[model samples]
Target: MAIIRDRDLIKDWNDIPIDLIKSCIQEHQKSIPRLDLLENYYMGKHAILSRSMGSDTGLPNNKLIANHAKYITDIAVGYVAGDPVKYDGKQVDEILEVYKQGDIVSHDAELAKDLSIFGVGRELYFTTSNDSPIPKATAIDPRQIFLVVDDTVEYKSLFGVHYYPKRDLSNAVIGYSVNVYTEKYVIKYNVKDLNGQGYDVADRIPHYFDGVPVVEFWNNEEQQGDFEQQISLIDAYNLLMSDRLNDKEQLVDAILMLKGGISIGDDEEEAGRTIRMLKKYKVLELPADGDASWLIKNLNEADVEVLRNAIREDIHQFAMVPNLTDENFAANASGVAMKYKLLGLEQLAKNKERYFVQGLRERLKLFANVLRVKGRAVDVSDVTITMTRNLPANDLETAQMISTLSGSVSTETLITQLSFVDDPAKEMERLNAEKDVDMKRQQKAFGMPINQDVTVDAE
Candidate 1:
């Protein structure tokens, strides 16, 4: 394998022979496996570095030097000679070509800069010489694109710390290694103690070293899990609270509906049972008036009495009356009457006794209507209406008769008596005279129009 550095190589590359290009592609493919292996090693090393030692601290100079020396030995043994099965010159060349063309070596430079920022050299053993330009190679394409290879790379603390020796002459013992200590130092920090501290330790540590914090490496898997659990608990609590509030609202609505006169129970016992059921479901509470009040307020006694009378009438008709031909009469009279009787017989039925006040109220409404028709004043108070029964039967009968006669009285005689003369002038004169007489009477009653004599006519 040869390194192509000729100026004409760029132009010739465009027209490279098909066979050579094919050879290049095949060679590139073969080299792909080794390159992949190298990448994996590089990535593994980076991961170790990131997880253990801070990248901003200067590298352990001794460890780095030892690692580099080992790495070089491995490359030579693994690719150049030691084992033919493990080494292939053509594959190695292809890998190098890929790195050269892609200019991926710049990535190494970036890694070195980051490592210097991490304070990695504080404890590591390695050497850096200003005389030696970092052992680096470049392949330029004249097209402004170039590949760089950095071989003799050394880490430096961006924070100006030279904790580790420039070169480790002393043989230090590191992880069961003695002769020159050939391994990278991977630091492990305890993150458990930092939970709930608010401030990010990783972020703070970098600032102490005058470096930007790379929080991406902070371990937060456990914290994330705890956060999710807390959210779930809060959601559950909210759902339960909402359900309780909704139930209370429903109970209030039911109470209002009952007060508004919607009957939902048959009797005191039934109403009590219904209330109990609501309470059992945590939807209602027993009011101060108790269950009896709920029953009396909601049931209409007059309607129940009407239904009872209708039923009795139907039962009598069914038992005594002959064949009933009308379907409407049969259905409404018989069926409805039977239903009323059955309900009346039932101890738990809604009846007049359950809603006595409601019955009285309804009767008063009818009496008011009758009074209106008879041109009589309606007794607005409950006291007047309730005292109706206390009046003698004869007196009540007479009053009813008088009311009926008053309603039937003809208005024709009254209209005739009230009629006026046909002539408008005569009617106006009569009206004026009547008005004058009325005014004089009013003045006399009040001791004269005192201001009239004081008025003087205009000259």
Candidate 2:
């Protein structure tokens, strides 16, 4: 539980007993592999295809089931980190430019998606070069790494170990080892770094802070996902949809039957004949009297619809992701009314916003440290984040509402709420420039030179 200080010798980190490191990994490995499963489910990669019902007999309809897992998570992430979060402070434009150049919005979206997938998402912040336009943040899947916090406090992570593979020059895999991260140091440790005679401090790279460079985005404080509670529902939903499709096929085609004495080759030949007849011809020839009467089935469309609706309702209910395409929400509604409809989503967004803010602050802190090392030190302590929901609302009405707030609201706040402006700070700059041009034109019209500054009291 001791704090890893900059003055701490490299031996303190490297001299850890082999048994202790093994125990740390042993305790957490069991829980790490499930992350891959959850991520696959989110991507609709395996759950639909892998889980098979015993009665997949005739047709090979391998159509994937309704993948609501991806929808719910995508909507949740779209709301959580939808817009680009800005850093507000003097000389922070350089940092903002860096984020813009790096496409931080897409990077954050990937982070949120992984957060939903693995319950824990991580980003590695590092500078590519001294003259790098912006520091890079690489999103790492939780399967390749584990997040470790102090066993006592449970929230303070002093460091993290990333187990990435070491490949040869020809891109052949050799082995994997842990890369240890702290604020002031990043040390690569292999089996040798752990057991070698003495610590080689020369290999360590110094950084700005004395904490880990990894910023984590947790789906929840307990590190659980939105669909975890109703994860089984996804399987059930897919099974039902697949069964329905299979049933529909059987019901409409009317499985051919030979009631009386009739020869139709073997089962494979019968299947091929049936397929050929269904696709090419509609006529069926019955050899004997009352030989075929069409084995029709009544599958109760109402019951299937009920079951499908129930499963869908349960999924959206438990996931807290409402069906945006619901007919009930088809009407064009006010923002406040729509907000009420999205109350559950709003609640989930609040939780995500809280966690996302914590990670973003850590991100800015790393940026600040890197900038300090470059002699362009910036204070981003007071920088705050605001998340705007990408919801359907009447924009003109909202703009009119903002107009009513004349002196009550700040121009920056108004610009943020305007929806058309992507960056409020930059829009404010544009507005000021336009104002200066207008004043210069007015001064020249009044026989006043445009070179002199205009005073407020001079009017």
Candidate 3:
């Protein structure tokens, strides 16, 4: 199934065929399971299964991989979009107060985390309550929403389809929508509510809207997770890792290697009893000319360790995530040194920042429309979205540098670079407060009146 190249619909999304939308949504359904698997891996819900040979012996140990794929995703996204976007649009500040009122920061972080795992994230804008001052933006799981695009001209996504399940008065309704340019066409049908227990038909037709209220985000144009390709490497590592553990277990509870003719039992029950007795007593009685020797083989621990490390390193390399466990990240590593170690991650973070900032701008544009309808049109185009990495930083070293570069850069530069300062304006206020307190203390120490006002330069 493919999206028909409707060049005519480029400017008018409403001209797109309804059948095309339905076909795309249906075709995309098959990919949902694959997305779910990736999500499950990120959630640490591995599918390793242990097998049991017979009921007592030869146990098949299936251990999950280190799940570093999820680890890589968390660290990358945490360092990239971990911090909230610092709003620089003076006019959009009041417009975004509604977001703070809705706790959009936490929600946006979660969405970014998911985007790291799936390479796709989205936010649906709508009013949550009657008194909602700002429209609420909801983070949507990619699996729940399939983006229909003309594979060739999806760069702008001027026309597309999306389907998701929503709860209605009686049951979960499968809803589909086609977004053209800025308008949205929606249709919904009732289905079993996941559990297949209840059913309700939400009577809704193909409703039309003036705009697509959702803003889609992607890690990049390719929309593939960092560790997605290394999944096979992860599996290889898990297999080898599990083998080493299994070897140790077997050595502790080794198999019985019997030799020569030894008849100690006449029936199955007797045979079982004799086998247990041999193991318990660690002894075996045989004929006068019979002989036996215990058999045990050592596992190649060094070989397994080497293979495990190699696979782990490859996973880290492919994911562009630093192995924090690496001994190279020793004690007292400077912020610059850590950044060097995580150079690839920092670059990835930069790319993510660029892509995410575009989505944020679009969201602002959509919100701007809402605000305009309310007679408060805020041009968020001037707003600069700053993505600060939540990486480890040595505040002392950073302060020293700031002091060294005093007057060279703006004071705002020093405040913004400080890892602890999420908002420069607020940090400035806090610094002033601390400085005032220190000045009062110093005045008392000098036997001066506490009421004396002295400008204490904290520089």
* Index of the highest-lDDT prediction: 2
Deviating ranges (above 4 Å) for candidate 1 = 1-213, 216-219, 222-225, 256-459
Positional deviation of residue 13's Cα in model 3 after best superposition, in angstroms: 3.4
- What are the clash counts of all predictions, listed in order? 24, 3, 0
Q: Lowest-lDDT window of 10 residues in candidate 2? A: 1-10
> Against the hidden reference, what TM-scores do the models get?
0.13, 0.80, 0.79
Q: Extract clashing residue pairs from model 2.
A: 183-209, 183-210, 183-211
Model 3 residue 356 lDDT? 88
- Residue 372 error, candidate 2, Å: 1.8
Q: Write the number of the candidate with greater TM-score, choosing between 1 and 3.
A: 3
User: How do the candidates rank by TM-score, highest first?
Assistant: 2, 3, 1
What are the C-alpha RMSDs, in order, of all predicted structures? 49.1, 5.3, 6.2
Kindly report which residue stretches of model 3 are placed more than 4 angstroms away from their true locations once superposed: 1-17, 50-59, 129-133, 147-154, 157-162, 165-210, 258-290, 426-459
lDDT of each: 0.29, 0.72, 0.69
Estimate candidate 3's alpha-carbon lDDT, on a 0 to 1 scale: 0.69
Instruction: Tell me the deviation in Å of residue 313 in model 2.
Output: 1.5
Query: Tens-digit lDDT track for model 1 on 122-154?
Result: 111122235621112222111111111112232
